[model samples]
Target: MTSSSRALLFLLACICWVPVTAGAGERPARIVIDPGHGGVKEGAKGPGALREKEVALQIAHRLRSRLEAAGGEVYLTRERDALVSLTERVEMTNDHGADLFISIHANSMPTPRMRARTEGVETYFLSASASGEAALAVADRENSEAPMSRAARGDSTLALILDDLVRTEAHADSSRLAYAIHPRLVARTRAADRGVQQAPFFVLSGVECPAVLVEVGYISHPEEGLKLGRADYQEKLAEAISEGVLAFLKDTRRRDAARPAQVAGSQTP
Candidate 1:
């Protein structure tokens, strides 16, 4: 069967069943999953009739399932085939006080005739500007022409004044989270292991927590696209991501616990 048909079948199967729930008194880690493109805006297209929106939604659902099964509190930016603005998506995560923000996407290349050999996992953290080609490509896809005021864009002097506040706070954790998960993803995919990097992706910029935009694999790569469309591959991909997230959370908690205690002892007489 064609990939789209297969994806539809998979989605139906998920919908038909009730998701397994977690045990009592378990405080699941809160996660916000953003399915890349939706509604009229089909992000990218590939061979075997793979649309970016379709794959993103499918992956987001699967990812949510994986995270929830591991006792994570998961929320999706878009549950169905509908358009959600970037600004709104960020606000949702921020408002919900989500622990992490993960925007799921599939990649497409400019050159259609480019060979199908390119395959890998690329994860991105927030940055002020793109330093390279991979960064540029991600930025270009995400920086859609949604209308925004000059102030919000940091085009005004006052906005620039608070830039440091904006910069120093959230993105540090985001970078650390990305670093933690990326290597695990590379190891699991066993594809081209493009290491973690920073870029000015709109999706990652506004959130006030650890955030990442995951380009799981190049859908334009014919061979990889076929693999991505399979249920087995999807399960493996979700499993790897889950493992990475769990490891990161555990390590972070331990590191936090190791810091020396501040005792207000021996006050001046």
Candidate 2:
């Protein structure tokens, strides 16, 4: 072939050689939001009878609105004052093939005195062991509804070890999601930054995708409790969470796009 013809042919060949990623035109990510506690299972109680279940549901509703506006397909485990099992929550998330799971709750200390001293937001992902006393305590309180028998707990430990590879990746993604959300939550609410943590939260276990449990604030704290009861504050919390979710999803999409594709080689005829 002439030099000019050969160059043109090579360019066409190169264009044909490019690999196509399977999910290049994937739809917007799906997300599951779990509002902690409901019905008879009211979560922590604050002064003026402000219940965690009620606050969590409100936040979840607001978050769903924001996420939907950002082009995410959002699902909430519970939309009202109704009890939902932890297993059911996990199943819902997996069934939807959600990209992320967020469990929302208001925190509380053991005693009124302790609650007064503690005020802030902390995010957590599943782990066999908690990051610290506070994380363990939070996990314990959250797990109370779905208490695992000693045998079940043992089985869960084994499952964690047996599925190490899957769990490790999920854990890493969960941590990244937590970090992405926690900072914005703290900034928007102007709450103390309790930082991200790891804990054996039953609600977060067995999720197929990155999952996190967020403690928005201490409901037992006199001042923070009042804030948690306010509709305006709840809206702010929802906005921050939505921002974080969009940020994480954007990063995930970028990483997926940068991944190397499997190129199919042509055979000599």
Candidate-wise lDDT, in order? 0.74, 0.84
Cα lDDT tens digits, model 1, 1-269, are 99999999988655322222222553556889999989987887767677778888888899889888666789999999899988889899999898888988877777767635666778888766555976776666767634443335653543343355356745677777788778877787776886787766767766878888888888888888777777777777777776667766666656656988766875565
| Pairs of residues clashing in candidate 1 | none
For candidate 2, the lDDT comes to 0.84
Highest TM-score model number: 2
TM-score of 1: 0.79
Say which candidate scores most in lDDT: 2
Segments of candidate 2 deviating more than 4 angstroms: 1-24, 147-152, 155-168, 263-269
Q: Tell me each candidate's TM-score.
A: 0.79, 0.85
Q: Where does candidate 1 stray beyond 4 Å?
A: 1-27, 115-117, 145-169, 260-269
Backbone N/Cα/C clashes per model: 0, 0
What are the per-residue Cα lDDT tens digits for candidate 2 across 1-269? Answer: 79999999988654322221124465667889999999999999998879999999999999998877656678999888997888888889999998889999999987767977999888888877779987877888898877674245785674565357344677788988998899999899999998889887877877888999999999999999999999999999998998787777767767867998856675455
